[model samples]
Target: MERDKLVYKLKEFQALEAYQVDLFQSQIKSLEDPHIKHAFERFTVREQEHEVFIKDQLYSFNGGTGIVGPAFKFAGMVTGKALDLLSLKDRLKLGIAVEQKAVQMYHEFIEMTRHDPQLKELNKYLSYFMIDEELHQFWFKEHLARIENIEAQPH
Candidate 1:
């Protein structure tokens, strides 16, 4: 029963991630700037991949919808659109914050599954993904700075 609960939680997280990915993709679709659109598209794809990975792991346990996916979709739409207008530095800062939250969630899930062997293994993969996301945030920030420097040139 407890394992079932954990599976449900994982499924809920996956669904939320999926909803956000959809929302991000939609927001990116409206952007005119290629570079910004590309960044958003990349984020959307990465979120979608993470969602699928989580879903596959949780599906074996027959987990059902744990949270309201529609609500997540709506919230993500609003947030993603607002973020799309921010400067690259702000976007990267926001990404870092989001990744930190994800890392915390993964850590909490890891602790919650202390008794579940399979979930513990999944948690290790999730931790690696969280690290990857953190690296992405750093790279975005660095790239933003480089862009700013180039734009500062006299023309």
Candidate 2:
């Protein structure tokens, strides 16, 4: 992928991660279920860590390259508002959906770079992201299943 296009998409995605970090943080306080709250706390920290890595990647570029760090930071700050608007169950479902999408996007990026030897390092980094996304999806699904079970029980 071209650096400009790659950086553009990456920064955009990175911002989403930042949004997720915030959302997860809020969930820590809002979630009543101990299991779900614990998971949210775990994911929140992971999201924050990913934000730092994403920031590093975005910062590696200069404006002359048509992709800047500050631009990405601003863009990331704009995402995840919809999560706040969602109900608790819907929020977990949406998170699972988004994480699935993230995995797919990383897969596509990896495939796109398969023919380019220059991007091997990038592919490696993205593979780690793909793994993390999948794990996040699993955790979200687990939380949903647990919540659904709880909701199904008699009061």
Candidate 3:
């Protein structure tokens, strides 16, 4: 793809991701557990920071006025509300899946963009997010396993 087209695509992606920022904050409200609430709070902050960085990257194009991204069909905030209703086991399962999805998205971006010299810096930025997502997934999964083990007990 041409440089302009690639840049445009990235801008759109950034915008879509930016739209998801509020969902993270909403999630923190849904979590009752102090540790989980705190974790989501951190995720919320990072997401907001990520939005700013993406906006800055798009600043030169369209005067930083265009967050023209593809539409996200599902209501993510509604998902957070639903998560609040689920049991801890269910929430952990879904949270881990969410992190895994983020990791997958970064890998896909890296795979598609790494070959382009222009995208090298974006790939580097995405790699950092991927690592964080992986770590979050690990943290959640470990807790989930402990919960499962306790439930599996003969008590």
Candidate 4:
């Protein structure tokens, strides 16, 4: 891929990671469960790391950090607030959907990078990010199932 094109793609991913960080951080503040809040805190940190990694990759190509737009950030915040009003199971379901989309995005990017010799490192990073997203998805699924199971139990 051309340097400019690769940089543009990286910027897009960086913006996404930034949005996720904001969303998770906002949700963490409203979570009453200590375990859930802690998980979100960790997710926020991981997403921040992903953003920084993408920013550094952009810098390597002499591309400036493409700052996420204010409107996008605002949307994430609003979404997080709306999600907080949902039941825990509903929140987890949404989280699973979000993480699944992220995983798919990373997987597609990784496949695109497969034929480009210059993108090997980026491909590796994308794989790592994808795995993290998968883990997040799994966590949400597991918790959602647990919630459903408990609700189904005889009182």
Top candidate, metric lDDT: 4
All models: lDDT? 0.66, 0.73, 0.68, 0.79
Clashes of each: 0, 1, 0, 0
Candidate order by lDDT, decreasing, is 4, 2, 3, 1
Model 1 Cα lDDT, one tens digit per residue, 67-122: 42222222233364576677655655665566556666666766676666756677
- Mind sharing the TM-score for model 4? 0.87
TM-score of each: 0.66, 0.75, 0.77, 0.87
lDDT: the better of candidates 2 and 4 = 4
Candidate 2 lDDT, 5-37, residue by residue in tens: 667767776776777787678657667779778
Question: How far is 30's C-alpha from truth in model 3 (Å)?
Answer: 3.7
Q: Positional deviation of 4 in candidate 1, in angstroms?
A: 3.8
- On the 0 to 100 scale, the lDDT of residue 135 in model 3 is 83
| lDDT at residue 15 of model 3 (Cα atoms) | 51
Higher-lDDT candidate of 1 and 4: 4
Clashing pairs in 3: none
What is the TM-score of candidate 3? Answer: 0.77
Error in Å for residue 82 of model 2:
7.0
